[model samples]
Target: MTSTARILIVEDEPKLVELLTLYLEAAGYACHAVYDGNHVDEALTSFKPDLMLLDLMLPGKDGLTICKELRQHSQLPVIMVTAKVEEIDRLLGLELGADDYLCKPYSPREVVARVKAVLRRYQPQAPAAASTTSGVHIDETRFLAQLDGVTLDLTPVEFRLFALMTHSPGQVFSRDQLLTLIYDDHRIVTDRTVDSHIKNLRKKLEAVRPEQEVIRSIYGVGYKFEEGSV
Candidate 1:
């Protein structure tokens, strides 16, 4: 069984907050609840939660401001919760470095699932030798994949995709499999989503190293990483 993870619930709605706290505790997570945005700094300093479930609409300071402040100091995973379902709001949260977002009227179980997924991505792993033979070093500690001394600034999704593929070079993984690995709730995702993320990741990689195309797409199949290539 996985150990209990600490989570902070930063929502203003009392009833919803209680529901979330109860559900998270039942799911074997240690939870700390705060109702006002003004208390975020203090809670962050004291609670030191593994993940934060932040609501966009708060009483004092608004979620976006708090998110920006937190990102300046720490890369701690944050999942934004908002009553607004607009695409702009979602994009803004993602751009501000949120690991994930949950729209309001959501299931507590789904929230727990997302928290677990984000934790898995950000959690530290033991040191391992790089598989790349070209002196490329992959540092899981800093969430970086470097080749020939050039580092790639990958998003959370991109990093996870790269890590999984590099672990088993030359082995193909279907879109469904990759989706399940990256996201906890794969039931709602389509193959197109995976394709889009892969495209974006490739662009990021190409930005740093024009010649390196580690991830390869198989016609009518899926994607795989080249052997000995990081």
Candidate 2:
């Protein structure tokens, strides 16, 4: 993540905002803050932050609703911070298009790390390092993807994740590692967001080659791709 990256902190507690600002600023992020959910949009427009650290329970509007509405037009990465530990709340937040969620009573350092992780993922980097993997080929220059000579329609995230795993066939990539392969550290997400991406990518691969299992999930580990002997 760039040191010039801007961060918007949304929370009701003044002390928490101060604490976060202290840590985030030290980590080289410029931060703007809002105490109520109602002020989120105005701040978003004016601040134009690269990422947002949103508190789930706010005085007005609330995080889930704000997130849902934001997803309608913005791709800004949001990391929801909340005290709610319920499984449903986490699922709801993810469903609402939050990039990641952070449970409250969290560490300031972890918050900074999450901020870096999400921003790193959000920012566009150079194209895939390696192009071809067996029958699957990616034309980074033309931005084309093909599975066994058939064009594959994939989202950008799916494309990058696909490129990473296929580039290193048979090598394992844990969820976090896959999220930021360009880096060795940084926990991008706590949940199985990576699994959902892998699932979608597998479906696409399945459509072209029904009998071949190109992507393999290792139990209790992570995911890897197999070229399956030319």
Candidate 3:
């Protein structure tokens, strides 16, 4: 498909932004740039980019703060770019609602590919009737999930994992397998990243049904969904 998708690059490094813009534009996307975190809102309102490539640290507002605030009003897909390699940093970024994460020294081409993957998966599909199975209900068109009829505020990545695991019930999905489903770019994201997602997913699920632990870790193997007895 010929893409006219708009992207906002939020990076303090001018050269990096230029490189990303070069690659993204080459990949058939239109790109705008914000050099500092403070200017993100202005760009979002004026440029109306379909996606944002956000830097973790900046002069004014940090990426995490911006992401948390943005999620309050918008569900625009986000891919966090950061220099920090710590797993906790990655978890925080994801927990703050980032769609994907990229550590620094990343390939611009790969970033472009990730942008395409996230955008492709995130595109709204035809509204389907909410289907309830195994005690969970998800609306594809709405990108909404409900447990015990309580709405879940799930990120795209979280939603995909929840739906896949819930659909299979008892099937154990290894980290690699789960990563393949959530992140299509085939990049090297750490195990903690996967754990972070599972942790967040469980929290959201438990919020709705506090007594039941639907998703259980299988130690060294992976994780699976089990409809616990109530």
TM-score-wise, the better of 1 and 3 is 3
* Cα shift from native, residue 197, model 1 (Å): 2.8
Candidate 3 ranges beyond 4 A from true positions: 87-94, 228-230
Give all TM-scores, in the order shown.
0.77, 0.66, 0.90
Q: Write the per-residue lDDT of candidate 2 for residues 1-230, one digit (tens) a residue.
A: 57889999999999999999999999999999999999999999999999989888899899888888887777677888779667434454244656667787999998988788777765555765545677778866455678878987665456677777777788888876775653224544443567766777788888988887878988888888877733
- Clashes in each model (backbone N, CA, C under 3 Å)? 0, 0, 0
Give the per-residue lDDT digits (tens) of candidate 1, residues 31-116: 99999999999998999888899998899998989988887667778888878767434454244667777888899888878877
Distance from true location, Cα of 109 in model 3, Å? 1.3
Which candidate achieves the best TM-score against the true structure? 3
lDDT of 3 by residue, 178-218 (tens): 98888787776678777878898888888877877778889
Task: Name the candidate, 2 or 3, with the larger lDDT value.
Answer: 3
| Model 3 residue 126 lDDT score | 76
* Whole-structure CA lDDT of model 2: 0.77
lDDT of each: 0.78, 0.77, 0.83
